[model samples]
Target: MRSRGCAEFSIPCPVDLRKYLSESEKCGICNLTSNYICRFSMKKNEPFEETLGKTAAQMSSQKENRNCLKGPLVLDFLFAVLPYSAAKKLFDKKFSIPVVSFTNLGVLDWRRLDFGNGKINDAYLATAVKHPPSFQVSVSTFGGRCALCSSLYATEKNRRVAERFLDGMIQELESAVSPSSHKAPAKSQNNAGGGSSAQRQPAGQQEGSDSKGERADARDKGKSKSKPKRKKTVHQK
Candidate 1:
């Protein structure tokens, strides 16, 4: 209840909207305490909210629903790597765009429309991580002509960029390959076993040290288990 004295003509009356407490009762004491006590116990207060706010919560919910729609949306578009010649062949096969002389077309950089086609705002050949192990130049399209990159390699730069881009991608993936660096744990895993590699570590080492040590200890643990089985058989014999 609001902390105000209950003596206002405009005060809402629960008895009925049309009824009012008598003017004579303004000074006369009735059961203000009981009335307030009953109201507090019976009535549920409305939850408090900021006076002014624009909710991003509703907008976020709407965005999530829209994301569920089929195919990639404009906002969800991603760069894909494909061979330059293959990409050109695809465009040539699908669309009627010509893949003739390189000089007639303006070489695309960041600013210029990528291909002469009005659909593509820009085109470039660059190294990317999308293709791993081997470097191969692939055409990239943005804005509109991105759809046509598969059919034609229009500019000299496009071909070179594609080649360079593939080179870089291969280099990046290869760099991640350190000799003897097995990506998976060497130990055999069980179908129902819940234990992770971390859990296999001996108790004394810190987690950081345990990670490297676990691999080294794998063979030792196997030998230890086999030793226990052999010892039991020897005792029985």
Candidate 2:
């Protein structure tokens, strides 16, 4: 059983979503591809949202289940169809919305998800810049604990602000859930978000690190299991 008052306690969650697009142009829409969003919200939370909010979430998942992508794709099409001025107007209007986009990824038994190797312990969803909002809040539950990870893609000043905001939210959540167990760790920043090279390291760094580490670990295991060679003494006649 989990400790009584430590249910809400959690290690600090860190994410750096600011990725300057220098050569994303390979995809044609690279310049405009900055607007990235993740499926952070869960299916059950759909009912808690307001009118348009709930409808968008439900429709997207429902269409996805039906082998259709039209529901969410329409939003992209709308942006594409709008004139430059109209698009800018829309952006300006949305800029007034909350600086952070919050959503939950539902509960996942990540402990059961394995890649023929070690199982996954925890996971978080982070996305790149999309329009005015520079931050996105993602919630996920694993091993019976809820984790909130937020990503930020903005200028240095804005990045600090967003980071502090996330830290505050984490504290608030912990406090609300279990006041006695409220002990927040200091936050650390690693360019590596979610341990993905695409997110943290350079193109090849992630693979390189993982491969080297795995090889080293395997060598250690092999050494530990191998029996020491016995030396046979030859009798001199």
Candidate 3:
């Protein structure tokens, strides 16, 4: 089968991207290639040292880089590249954290460097050509595919894990764009009930109409009292 980029560059659905970046999105491009980046802030109440240590441990564990780096910084770096969907998948599957080191470039390094020199060379070339500080993983293609499962799917358990990751990633995208926002309104099951729009009224206007009626009634009552028909005085002339 033909490779991913060479054969055809399928555009990723925006919903899928949303599943990847939940709250915010940041993308950096170089040489016409782009990579998304996002950052999440730390809780303010914790001491710097405590927060730092916890973050360091998490990043080292998640990214699988042993060197002690500050948590917020590590999170920022991760936030930029690994979407919540991918990050959640990696954690759920118990895969080692992947690091982004420019020297290593666009290569997916999961602690042990099992991928050979040629693969490494290809990874480096891909990164250099693309110039995004992060690596992109595609389920279907090599290099672009998962680093852990590409080989581990020999057993049923591993296959299940792989499927979960792929499925979760897709679900993430699907959930990102709300159905109401992206999809056309469907024919209602209760079409006789006058469809979706008929059942709901705008809250502000609904209240305004009631208030207006009350004001008009008050005005009518005041006018009736103030202009009580002057007793048609039988002219006593």
| Highest TM-score against the true fold, candidate | 2
Q: lDDT score, residue 49, model 1?
A: 22
The residue-by-residue lDDT of candidate 2 on 1-237, one tens digit each, is 121222221121122222322555344433231222323323332222232353356446543442223323554676789987887687676534334455555666543464678534334344433333545556665443444444443455654555555555544444434455434445543211222111122112322224312211221344433211111010110
- What C-alpha lDDT do the candidate models reach, one value each? 0.25, 0.39, 0.28
Instruction: Point out where model 1 deviates above 4 Å.
Output: 1-152, 179-237
What ordering of candidates by lDDT runs from best to worst?
A: 2, 3, 1
Q: Which of the two, 2 or 3, has more lDDT?
A: 2
Per-residue lDDT over 135-199 for candidate 3, one digit per residue giving the tens place of the 0 to 100 score: 22232212332111122213444334433443333333333323332321343211111111111
User: Which candidate, 1 or 3, would have the higher TM-score against the true structure?
Assistant: 3
lDDT of 1 by residue, 1-237 (tens): 312322221211111111234766567544221000011111133211210011223333433443223222221232145566665565556533112211111233443443444233123343222222222223333321211111122344443343333333223222233333233223332110111121111113213432222221222344432110000000000
Top candidate by lDDT: 2
TM-score of each: 0.17, 0.37, 0.19
Q: What are the per-model numbers of colliding residue pairs?
A: 21, 3, 9
Residue 137's C-alpha lDDT in candidate 2?
58
List runs of model 3 lying over 4 Å from the truth. Answer: 1-153, 180-237
lDDT of 1 at 131: 25
